[model samples]
Target: MSDTLTIALAQINPVVGDVAGNIRLIRDARARAAAAGADLVVFGELCVCGYPPEDLVLKGAFLESCEAAVHDLAEETAEGPAMLVGAPWRVAGKLHNAALLLDHGRVAATRLKHNLPNYGVFDEARVFVAGPAPGPVAFRGIRLGVMVCEDMWYPDVAETLGESGAEILVVLNGSPFEMDKPNLRLEHARARIAETGLPLVYVNQVGGQDELVFDGSSFVLDGQGRPAAGVAPWTDAVEITRWSREPDGWCCEGALAAPVSRLENVYRALVTGLRDYVVKNGFPGVVLGLSGGIDSALCAAIAVDALGPDKVWCVMMPSPYTSADSLEDAALVAGMLGTRLDTISIEPAMAVFGSMLAPVFAGREADITEENLQSRARGLTLMGISNKFGPMVLSTGNKSEMSCGYATLYGDMCGGYAVLKDVYKTTVFALSSWRNHTRPPGCLGPGGAVMPERVIAKPPSAELKPNQTDQDSLPPYDVLDAILDCLIEGEMSVPETCAHGFDEDMVRRVWRMLDRAEYKRRQAPPGVKVSSRAFGRERRYPITNAFTRLI
Candidate 1:
C-alpha cells in the first residue's frame, strides 16, 4: 500500500463544445502535473466539453466527440501520471455527468454524478439523468471518493462514500462566481469533511461562460476541517498538493492563497467575463460610447482592463445636451487609459431624424421621443463604427438603471455585451472608486487611477437634456439599490420591502418599474453575473404579469 501521494489540481478555462481544444487543455495540465511528480491529476467537472454545456450535450455527435476525446486522453496515461477528468459519459443508453479515471493508458473506472443541480443557473436535470450513489475509486493502493459538482452539496453521497471506505473525497466543480459563493463553497466542503472525517480536494474551472463567470477558488481541507491548501480565485492555476497517510487519516500540505476582498472579486468577475466573451466569440476588440457618466466611464475602464488599451476603442458621440464637463471627463478618461478616442457629433443625425419625422408630427411637442432620438442617433453611430470595424459595442447601463427603465432601449443599451448589466449603481460607484486606488491581480490596465476622481464624485447622468441627472427620473441610488436587493435578491414582497424602512408607495413604485422593465431586460445584452439574483437566467419574470398590480 502507498504511504504517500501527490495530487495536482488543474484549474483551467475551457470553451463549451470545443472537445479537441479541451483535450489539449487536459493534456497540458497533465504534462505539468507529471513534471511536478504527481501521482494523479484532477480537473474540474465536464472539463472535456466544458461545464454547463447546456443543450450541447444532448446532441449525439457532441457526446461522441467528448467520449472520443476522453479515450484519446486515456491513452496518454500509459506513460505519465494517471488522470481523473470529468466528461459527459453514456452508459446503458443513458447519459451521465461522469468522472473518468485514466490509468495504465486505458479507462480504468468511471463515477457518475449522483446529484444534478436544477436551480439558479443550473439545469442539469433537464440534460442528464442522475447516477446512483457512488463509492470510492481505487487508485495507487488508495480509495478516493469522487463526486461531481452538485454531488458534494448534499450529505448522502459523501456519507455513502465514507461508509464504503473512501479515504479522500475529491470534488470536480464548475461553480460560477457570486459575491458570497466562495464562503458557501468552503462551508459545504468543510461540512462534507466534517461528516466523512476525510480530507477533501476541490478543483474548479475558471473563465467566463456566457453570463456566468467561474472563479477558480479551488481548495483543500484536511480531516479536521482546516484549510490545507488553496488556488487563487479568478485565474487558472495548477497547484500540486502532497498528501500523507497519517495515523488518524490523510493530511494535506500545500500553499494557501490570501483572501480576496469582495469588491476585488466583483471587479475581477467583470474583467474575466468581458475578456472571455470577446475572445471566445472572435471579436477583435470593443468600442463603447464614453459618456462622462459613471456607468460609461466604468465600462470603459473595465474594457481597457479586459482587453488592453490598444484593443479598446472609445468614441465621444456628443449631442447638443452634452456638457463641457462631460466632454472633458470623457477625454481625460480616454487619455488616462491610453485608448483611441474619436469624437463623432450626433447632431447631424438628430436634425435629419427630426426633419424626416416633422411631416408626420406637425404640432407635437418634443417629449421623450426626441430624447430617445438622440440616444438612437448615438447608438447608430456606435453600431456603424462596429460594422466598419470588427469591434463589438459595449453597453454601459447598470442593473439599477435597467431595473427602473431609466435607460433607453437600443439607445445606450445597444451593445454586444453589457459589462455592468448585473451590477447596481451603488456597486458601480464603489467599483470605480476601488479601481482608482487598487488594481486587482492579472488586470491588463495601468496600476494608477483609471479615471479622474471627479468622474466618480460627479452626479451620474445620461445627459439627454440640459442639466439632466439620473436622480431626475429615479430615486437616490443608495435607497434604490437597497430596495432592489430586497425585492429581487431577497424576493421580499412590498410590505416586507417597505418594512426595511422604505416608503410603501416608493417600494410599490419600484416593484412596478421592475416588473414593467422585464421586456427591455429580456432584449438587453448578456453581462457578467456577480449577484445571486442576476437578471437573465437566474431570475426570470413574466413580461405580461399582474403580480406587481396585485401587490
Candidate 2:
C-alpha cells in the first residue's frame, strides 16, 4: 500500500440553490488539487446543493438536480484526484445528506451522515433522515472514515469508525460563526481524534447564507490529536495538505492558518454577511440613514467595506432637532469613505404628519407619539429610496436598543436588512475604534480613521427631541449592555441578575423591557449573527406571555 496521501481542502463558498455554480466550484477545486499532485480533494457538506438548503431539498426536482450534479462531479474525476463531494441523496423515497467519493469517473462509495443536528440554527433532522452508523470508505487502499459537520461532535460515530479499522477521519462542516466557536471546533476535533487515535482532516464552508456566515477555518490534526495546520478564516482558499503514513500513523504537513483577532472575526462576519446577502438577493447596492451617530457610523463603514464605497449611499434626513455637529460629522464620515451622501430634510414631511395628527389628538399632550413620528418620517424617507432605487435600506439598530424596546416599530426599524441587529452598543463603539485603527484587507473603502473621533466621544442621542439623549430613556450603555448580556445571553432571572452586584431595580426594569420587546424583535429584518444568542432564531420567546419579573 502507498505510504502517503496528498489531500486538498476545498474550503470554498457556495451559493444556495446554484447547483451548476457549485459543481463548477467542485470541478475547479479538483483541477487545482490534481495539479498539486494531491490524491484526494475534500469539500464541505452539501456542497452540491449548498448547506442548510432549508425546504429546497424537499422538492423532488431539486433533489434530482443535485443528483445530476453529483454525477457530473463524478465524471470530472477522469484523470485527476478523487473528490469527496457532499450532496443530497434520495433512497427509496427517503432523503439524506451524503458524502460521495468520486474516482475513475465513477462514485467509489457513499457515506450517509449518522447524526443530524436539530438545535439552534440547524434543522437537519427535520430535512434529512439519519443513516445507520457504518464503516469507512476505501480510497486507494486507505480506509477513511467520513463524517459530516454534526456527526463528529459525539463519540459514537468516531468510535464506530475506530472500531471498524478506519485509518483516518475526515470531517466536512458548514458551521456558522459565533464568538469562541473556532476554538470549540478544534477542541471537538481533538476529542474525536483522541477517541479514534486517527489523524483528522477538517474542512468547513465559507461565505454567508442569510443570517449565517460560515468561517472556513479548515485544519489538520496529527495522530496525537494536536493542531497541525489551518486555513485562513472568513475567506476562500484551496490548498493541498500533504499527509504521509508514518511508523506511528499519518501526519499532516500543511501550512498553519494565521489566527484572526476576535474583533476581526466579528468584523469579517458582518462584512461577508452583508456582501452575500446583497449579492445573492440581487440587490445592486445599499442605502442607509447616516445620523452622524456611532451606530450609523459603524454601519456605514461596514457597508462600504462589504459592498465598496461606490455601492453605498448615505442619506442625511435631518429634522427640527438636527444639529450642526451631526450634519458636519455625517458629511465628514461620508467624505472619508468616498460614498455618495444626500441630504433630505424631513421637516416638510414631519410638519404634514404633525398637522394631520394634531386634529386627531386635539386635547392630548405631545409626547412619545410625536417623537415616534419623527422616527417614522425618517423610516418613510429611507424606505422610499429603497423603493425608487434598487439599493436595500440598511437598518442601524443595535442589540441594546432591540433588547430594551428603545426602537420604534415602523420607524427606525424600516429596512431590508439590519447590519448591527445582534451587536451590542458597547461592541459597536469598540468596532468603530478598531476600524479607525486598521483597515481590513479586501475593504474597498479608504483606510485611515473613517469614523470621526468626536463621534466616538459624543453622548449618543436619537435627536428626536431637544436635550434628549439615549441615557434619558435608557440606562448608560455600559450598564445597559452588561445587564442585557446577563438577561439575554446568560438567561439569568431577575433575582439571579440582581445577585451579581447589579442594582435590583435596574435588573427588574431591564428584564421587563427585554420581555416586552419581543414583538419588535420579531418584526426586525435579518442581520449578521456573531453572538451565541441572537434575537431571531437562537432565542425565541412568546410575545403574548404574561410572565414577568413581577411574578
Candidate 3:
C-alpha cells in the first residue's frame, strides 16, 4: 500500500465532437502526470466527447466512437499515471455520463453521474438516462469516490460515496462560467465536504464551446471544508495535490499553490469565448464597427486581446451625424491597439437612400425610419466586408440596449457574433478601465491603454441621428442596468423591480421593451456569456407571448 497519494488534476479544454483530438489531450495529460510521479490524474466531465454534446451523443456511431476512445486511453495506462476520465457509456441500451477509472492498461471501475442537469443550456436528461448512486472504487489500496459534474451539486452522490468507505471525493465538472461562479463553486464544494466529512477535489473543463466558456478554477478542499489550493480561472495547466494517510483519515500533504485570481474573471471569460468561437469555427479574424462609444471601444479591446491586432480589423462607418470627436476617438483607440482602421463614409449611401425613400414618404415627418436607414446602411456595409473577406462581424450591442430593443434588428444586430450580448453597459465601462490599467497574462493585446482614455470618458451614442444619445430613447444606463439586473438576473416581477426604488412607469416601459425585443434577441448571433442570466440560452422567453408582468 502506498503511504502517500499524489493526484494530478488536468483541467483541460476539449472541443465538442472532436473524438481523436480529445484522445490526444487525455494521453498528453497522462504523460505529464506520469512525469510528475503522480499516482492518478483526473480530467473534467465529458473530456472524451465534450460537454452538452447536444444531439451528437444520440448517434450510435458517435457513442461507439466515444466508447472506443475511452478504451484507447485505458490502453495507454500501463506505464503512466492512472486516468479518471469522463465519457458517455452505453449500459443496457441506455446512455449515461460515466467516469472510468483506468489503471494498469485496463478499466478498473466506473461511476455514472447521478444528477443529469437539464436546465439552462443543459439537455443531458434528453439524451442520457439517470444513473444511480455508486460506491467508491478501490485504487492503490485506498477507496476513491468519483462523481460527474452535476452529481456534486447535490448531496446524494457525495454522501453515498462517503458511506461506502470512500477516503476522498473526486468531482468532475463541465461547469460553465458566469459572473462570480468560481466563488459559487467553492461554496458548493464546501457544503458537500461538510455533509460527508471527506475532502474534495473539483476539476473543471476549460475553454469556450459555442457560447459557453468554462472558466477552469479547479481547487482542493480539506475535510474541514477549507480551501487548500486553487488553480486560477481561465487557464490550462496540470496541478499536483498530494495526500497522505493520517490517523483520522487522509489529509492534504503540502499546500497547493495556484495563481492569484484577479478582478477580470468575467472579462477573461468574454475573451475566452470570443477566441474559441472564432478559432473553433475556423474564422481567420473578426471585424467590427468602432463607433468610439464605450460599448464599441470595449468590444474592440476584447477583440484585439482575444485574437490579437492582426486578426481584428476595425472600421469606422461614419454617417452625416457622426461626431468629429467620435471619429477622433475611434482613430485614437485603433492607434493604441495597433489595429488597422479604415474609414468608410455612409454619407453617400444615406443621401441616395433619402432620395429614394423621399417620394414614397412625402407626407410623413422625418422620424426614426430615417435614422434606421443609416444604421442599416452600416450593417450592410459591414456584412459586405464580412462576405468579401472571411472575418466574422462582431456586433457591439450591449445587454442594456438589447434588453430594451434599443437596437435595430436588421441594422445594428447584423453580425456573426454578438461580443457584448451578455455584458451590461455599466460593466462595459469597468472592464475597459481594467484592461487599460492591467493586462492579464495570455492576452494578445498590449498592457497599457488598449482602450484610449477619451473613448472611456465620452458619452455613448449610436450616431444614427443628430444630437442622439442613448438616454434619449431609454433611461440613464446606471438606472437601466440596475433595472435589467433585477428583471433578468434577479428574475424579479415588475412590481418587485419597482420596489427597488424605481419609477413604476419606467419599470413598466422597460419591461415592455424587454418583452418586445425577444424576437430581435432570438435572431442575434451567439456571444460570450459572463452574467448569470444572459439573454440567449440562460434566459429563454417566448417572443410571441402576450403575457406581460407590466400592468
Q: Which candidate is the best by lDDT?
A: 1
> How does candidate 3 fare on TM-score?
0.98
lDDT of 1 by residue, 209-306 (tens): 99999999999999998999999998788999999998998989999989999999999999999999999999999999999778888998999999
Candidate order by lDDT, decreasing, is 1, 2, 3
In model 1, where do residues sit more than 4 Å from their true spots? none
- Candidates 1 and 3 compared by lDDT, better number: 1
lDDT of 1: 0.93
Cα-based TM-score, every candidate:
0.99, 0.98, 0.98
Each model's lDDT: 0.93, 0.90, 0.87
Error of 1 at 106 (Å): 1.0
lDDT for each residue of candidate 3 in 1-551, tens digit (9 for 90 to 100): 66799999898889999999999888888788888888999999989998769899879999999998888778888866899999999888888899899988988898888998888888888989988898999998988889898888888888898888998999989999987777788888988989989999999989999889998888889999887767767888888888888877778754455544444787888899999999988999999998878888888888999999999999999987899999998899999999989999999999999899889999899889988888899999999999999899999998999999888878889998988999888888888888889897789998898877878877788877788888888899999999989999998999899999999999988988999889989998889888888888778999888888526
Q: Given candidate 3, what's the lDDT at residue 428? A: 87
